[model samples]
Target: MAIKYIPYFKDAIQGQALLDNFVRTKRILKYADNNEVKERIERGLPLYETEVTEIVGKESDNLVIRGECISACAYLKENNIKVDLVYIDPPFASGADYAKTVYIRRNPRIEETIKKAEEKLEIEDLKTFEEKMYGDIWNKEAYLNWMYENLMAIKSIMSEIASIYVHLDWHICHYVKILMDEIFGEDNFKNEIIWHYSWGSRIETQWNKKHDTLYMYSKSEKFYFNANEVLEERIISEKTKNRLKYKGAMITDRNKGRGDQEKALPTDVWYIATINGMAMEKVDYSTQKPEALLERIIKASSNKNMIVADFFGGSGVTAKVANDLGRKFIHCDIGINSIETTRDRLKETGASFKIMDIKDGVNLYRNPIQTMDKIKSLIPGLKNEDSVSEFWEGAINDSKLGLVPVYVPNLMDSSTKLLDIVLINKVINLAIPELPDEIKKVIIYYIDIIDKKEINDFIKENLGREIEIELRDLKEILSETVVDDVLEYRILNNEIVIDSFVSDRIIRKINEYNEKMKAQFIVKGGKTKFIEISEEGLELIEMVSLDCTSDKGIWHSDEEIKINKLGYTIENGIKTKKFWDGKIKFLKRPLRIKIRNISGDEIIFNVI
Candidate 1:
């Protein structure tokens, strides 16, 4: 077949005879959904419910898991994050189309025979069919821009005493070298390290040449470089420490001489290609660079705790080596297939990884519900009374308070209601028992009868801003009990968290309260701990109760919940039942109150 054409980076690998046309093995599609495959996610097995977690065994040295190389560079530039050394073996952008099959849901290329219509190519979904191929980039400007944007981001994230290595061939190597000069500064330009690897080639016209260039640059005039870190010096038999000691004494050693140190600090040309695919060190990426290549550059340049960033993280060779060597990494790639492949490659090697798995065309899989489930798991259980007492609460005395699901991205939306709340899936808050279980977000609505006269009186007296019921988030009314007759929120995390097990109405109420009071709750999940959700819409604060006394009971005044000290100082004042005028007094200061629950079996608040 004719070689596929790439306009931009063609020259880089064009003249170069393809070395590893099929050297690399098949890498795991980390993103592909394989029903048979099970991953050991960082989050421990659920006691009962499933939860999402960050990558397992990640290095603290790395910044964000999904960090971009350019993003890492930004941190280096801004001095926000740190980078001591950087290495990138960008795609040669080989225009020639390499061959491979395609799969979805981890299925083999069942549709390989079918031709993928050209129109399907433009669409975002990458399920089209055609023989897999590799090609160089067409637009040189676009490629440069793409490389430049990331380089700038990387520049920002590097340190002053850092170094960078750009590995390439003849094609765009010089062009990229120029770009590097612009990015790192010509003054700090180090050496163009030449790597010489020889494979048998018989060229009828000209002498066969074999080597790749590694351009090293630094941030400042000074950077870290350890001589010991360079490849171990080649030693002759006599040069061996033991042999040298007895060299003159033994005839065998006497003739042996010290191996000449290929002096002059490994000049422009380095003649060595450590290992190719046939070697056991082989990995899954088609462009899986040898670890020795990266180790040489990394060891020669930076020390421990330094950061590394790579943009074209094909197969994540740089990240894997850097991670194993005790350095942090910011790895990025635009290909969707490569994201998962890179992630798994780094992971299986036991090198900690903060992976940025990016893929194109396929839908962006948003996995953020972990945070909600964590919060839900911490809820306190409700205590049910004996059969006789349960009757009083379940039937006679307790009133039905409804609960519902709510989906509110923003509380400022006009479609929300005072009573309607969205129901978040149990997996997010309360764990749900279902496969492919998604958080069931819905708006809640409930209506209940109360003391009409007292309600009206209180509404009139307080001069409370009457909520525009119709204007607020209102939903269709429903009458039923899927779980119970009434809904209530049990205490959890020292706050009134949504008792998803309680009333669906309460869920809606919490959601409505979030809308009305602008309470913050977790939205995006993907957490394993108590991380704060700022856009949570409403603040989940601890409540402060007061020991104020009233004619009928102890009273506390509070418009919002507060975490208060003992004896309930009015940090957040205690609230009580309002009677005479119906106008509720929003107390700002401590008020004198009395207790009425003589039995102390319950706590009561009566506002005077």
Candidate 2:
């Protein structure tokens, strides 16, 4: 069976943080109007309504629940977005410290000095690197803990016909294997794919570790398996000489035989070619596996359009490759630089995707529940009311469920008012308006608690049979929605997350897409030796042109030019035009001409 997953951490969390939760937790709770809750209602224990979400196209049911895996798994189990496939890469636990950022000095003499400064780290980025990437989040213990928990949660989501792949190095692979076996059943253990590469770095004291392990596990005997999706050829060269014989004399001639030494089934111990120099892709996100390496894994496991997720999406290399191969993907990283890396890579491909952040929950989309519910409420017959707990709980699950409680700090006699909530079996049922209001100033409410007994008793006392009574605390979960009077838009935690959907504007034309309505940029190349190209050449152009003025410290110099943070390169040999504003400057045929240095390095340009 195909796996389905839903984000349910919000449900499993203790307490109702809303106003409606107080009224309902103290009273009887009813299931909201939705097909998923109809069965629960019949069971006399209706689950909280799943929030209807803002959706564009009718996307597939495949889900990618975004959370630190551990908390995420418990939440998924509480809800129902079960998963089918699991793959991840964890810390090897090798003694080497993995900082949030890395600083590389050109010479070995400065290594100790750099390490000393790094040890006495003040601001995050400076300590990590000369070329700092993402040090802030990379060094957080919280992120590492989240990774382990996700593995735990993933097990519950996996179906009987599901399998998981955990990638690890010598440091943590063994421990992760144990963890996987414990999470997934030990009986369902699959192969340990040893990805062997021929070359890279080696140690003089010992043999260099050139391969990594991919631990595969399945829930049961049957799983989704595609036989021939592997695009990679198993053999580098034909062994015609090895075909000495097939079997007995009658089976085949001496020259033509199905040689046992010839290419056969690709073993779990795959030895693929290593990625040395610029292999097809433009940049190498260090620790990135070769395309051929991932190709074999995909071929052995899935087919096109299968939903794939990578939580530790470092450079987003795996997800990018998966996308190119026509696979749907969900990849995330807590590190800012890593996310930037993913965004840049995806932008290059022009891939359409939603940006999800943990802090804000669903970043985009306005919750249309109130508008839809208000419409239904206006109709006399359609006014089927669920208890306040049920109402708010249901709101939580709706993909379009947007509930930002207005926090009036001094609304009550004391400093503030408390909106207490009662939940039952993770579904909020009762809501009790806290310690009375000093003035009649309106206070927003949310759900907080859902004790199972409280729900049962509330339902029995009110409606006879046991019904769901969910409690919620408004302050605990909900935030104030900033309704922009001028913009007619809502603010999410102070961020002006532009909602393109249902916007009043009729997009007569997409202003951003019009190439003519552009900020003209000036690009030039400095003198060079031969028509050669080094990464330095590209860096110089970018430093001077695209780099921001405030961040000029990041800019460096090359042989031909000195670059600035704004990506404006100063050609050292020949001076450039001072007032290059709006002129029909010609490259003579952009990308065709070779702007070379004395040492044979060349540079290319993409005008836009």
Candidate 3:
């Protein structure tokens, strides 16, 4: 096969032009209002509105928004939520899949069996599988377009003295650097800090790619940079110390007239180690950065109590570090896993924050990747059709309409999630024309719509082919009858005893994993042992909290217990070396009980 010579800078001019037009036009797409959002933008109205879903801890300025970065920034700008510092570790456009290791909790019921066998429960004994959080795959042009919009939105919400650090790798950082220059004026460009780490796989074909670039840009000329805050400890040579002693130099003179002689200003090239697996702060998130990395950035660019915002908060390290440094934070991400991880991590710090979700239609599942995986099973009669084009998800065998091709939007790509005039036109002008003649009808699933009537009218007027167009609300389909975990609990005296807990999702995942493993073992001619679950199924529960304060509305974890992967118990944010005993004691009469599964699914039951 011959190699295609596609230049790395292929979309430079086109991407710049697209960003320029976006800056000049100022058109926005608000899918939640069911109207053309550009019209609202022209009327000088907000692009998107955000609604607070849950208020965590006490009322404070800290925020954790579960939505797209662009929408979050737009809402922040509209609400005047400006930030002094911004650090975003976005997808690097590396064609790879990122997943979290889903580990089954230790079964306390099997303690006797484990003890009799003279074996201690280890991570290897636990049944674990990879659950994809998100995919970093992207077309170059599309990625640039998405990044441009996000960068512009971020720049809009930045304060006059604010600085942003865009974290990216070798794959797409150079391209985004150009976009950053265009969005935040080239004169405002500050530093291209190279974060050097030595904890990744080494390649023999070329030099190991171990560093990530952080492109720092300020909103204006006056940006915050306190060198003393991020000063590192300097190591003086023995020769230099001897010379200083012989010359009888003062401590201030030896330290360049500074009182602190040990600390020196950090350079643009930062050498920080990645998070270790066994580290106490490790949250098992794929792209989680170390606290030291964010500590330096947060301290140098932001002051105490100043607002720090991270739009692409992967594992909430930025938020946690910012809170530790006494800076209020706004953490935003589209993934539900990220939101839950950040929320739990922030809870450990006792920081008060409100969890907000943008009124966009993407809140159907845990995240887009899982939604896409379940989309096939959710749709009735939808099956894989190899003959159809890639644009179409699958075809359904209709009773009267014959073969109806179904077009499910790729949830990972935000561009396809909403159905508007432009997307409808693309379907009519590009996708529909390539469909087979026998396909009389097409079912298009959409997360959100601009206007159903407007889209229907556009399809009727522009579509030259005589085909029935059916637009189905994917959110409605996905919202139907979700199976929740079963919990059996009873209040005894002052303690609420959880008799048993069962997660249908966890059980299903276990069965599927065992069957796949069995097949693999059969192919390799090896003995296979299936993972067994206890009848009580108490092991599936990772956390159990009681909200004795209120039974309705916002959740307040009055008393809680979290069982870590290593069987250690964390009671009320304090980790104990002792394992969980499966008993929860409450201070007052419990009004509600919240149980979180090992995979982060939470189900709340009212005390009845």
Candidate 4:
């Protein structure tokens, strides 16, 4: 069934009208209370705040935040944290689910098996599974609304001289371009850069989609752009060289007597190669942009020591590039994978940054996708009903109210997380009216509320229908029990030896994968091969570190080893291309050990 809720910006709100509505009402859509917003507007207070979780390295101006982009922008704006440049490679709305290839690391405990089968093990022979990082699926109207709010939030925190490079692909770039113009002003439009790359699947039916669009816009008329900083080496032809030699001083004053190996300004069409497999810069992140691409953008738009911010910091390419360029950076993303990847990457670079989480009350799981997947089983009696619309998650059978349709917020969409007047009005005016006549009650689950009393009173006043409205706190049913990974370790002669490691999540995922494979094979009338794990289960461990220094607050990686997808170990910030020896030799007595699973879930153990 069709969703009955009317979008805020319906067909009537087009172009200037849409812009005018945002401007006149000052209603930049956000997941906050109307009263709080009004008070902030009246008192000139920041609309949002940030909570620092951990400080990595010496305290500096760099920040790596774990939260949604909208909330991150709100925090930055509230703190008056303006940046000179912003490069965001957000989801391209490709209707595709992107995942990271999770590889089972080589078991160091089984040295005899490894030595015998070393030559036989190809890259495909290694056990690997795909873990979904995030989904880029979106409804057109919802995508536009989300992008509009994000653009507005980002625009508010940008410095007058700041430049923003929005990296998107063919999926929804055109739509977002319109929103960008409305939020940042059409006059501030700079250039539409086409980043051409040569690594994607080829199709016989159509031309290969091997490039992405980067829309560059400035916050104001006078913005920074340094062509000299990002100049490309000119490819001179012999004919052109001879002509230039003959012309000598006759050429234009700028090019007069220029050498053959001259530097020229790069064009809007950048021909940078995509990061291929086996590339050192490849961090195995699905949406990771090439460092070369970010380098050019950062150099052209910003200077050294200036702050560069990336709200959609996938794999922290922008942060790393900015750090290498001697510029401070602010990296923000909602996924735990992104934050961990970025944190480890920046740590390798020895960059000092404070990690922060936006106080948005959505940190129930590693990310929204996982949370959405797990939310189904959490609520009792919440089952899929054929009668209800897709907008409603499912229906609950209540003894008193019969079949009550339930509306749960799409955690992936930040706008839906907070239950405010706008959302309540939508439910009352549109959604509840479309429910089946027999349905007596409607349950609305919320992540956060603006004000419970105000919302309930509004619902009572505006909900003219005789339906019982029940507002349920999603967080109430989201209580999680931490399952600690089993580890067997001991200090032997100043060396930490881990004999066995078992991750409950990894084992469960493996069983699930095997079961699915077996079912598929059964359908095909064939036998299925299951992935066998050694009793030691050392392959499940992705990285192992020993903190010989501190036992309390911040974790210091004194000695560490990270196993890449190809089964090579990166030891102590250096890629050895060698297998892990299953032991960490420490100079001091080890106090703690941290082991991360193949899926990025880490657990720590205190040494006795």
Q: Give the winner by lDDT.
A: 3
Candidate 3 per-residue C-alpha lDDT over 5-114 given as tens digits, one digit per residue, 9 for 90 to 100: 11211123233323443454334311122122222222221245556756778899899998877667667765677899999999999999998888766666677743
Task: Give residue 115's error in model 1 in angstroms.
Answer: 35
List the candidate numbers ranked by lDDT, top first.
3, 4, 1, 2
- Model 2 lDDT tens row, 499-584: 11111111111222222223322122433222112222221111111111122222111122322122123342233422111111
Question: What TM-score against the true fold does each predicted structure earn?
Answer: 0.42, 0.43, 0.88, 0.87
Instruction: For candidate 4, write residues 28-106 as lDDT tens digits.
Output: 4332233322222222212344667556678788999988776676566555688899998887778898887888777
Give the top-scoring candidate (TM-score). 3
Give me the overall lDDT of model 1. Answer: 0.38
lDDT of 4: 0.76
Per-residue lDDT, model 2, residue 196, is: 66
- Model 3 C-alpha lDDT versus the unseen true structure: 0.77
Better of 3 and 4 by TM-score: 3
Candidate 1 regions exceeding 4 Å error are 1-53, 63-79, 98-134, 199-202, 237-268, 356-608
Comparing 1 and 3 by lDDT, which wins?
A: 3
Where is the poorest 10-residue window by lDDT in model 4?
244-253
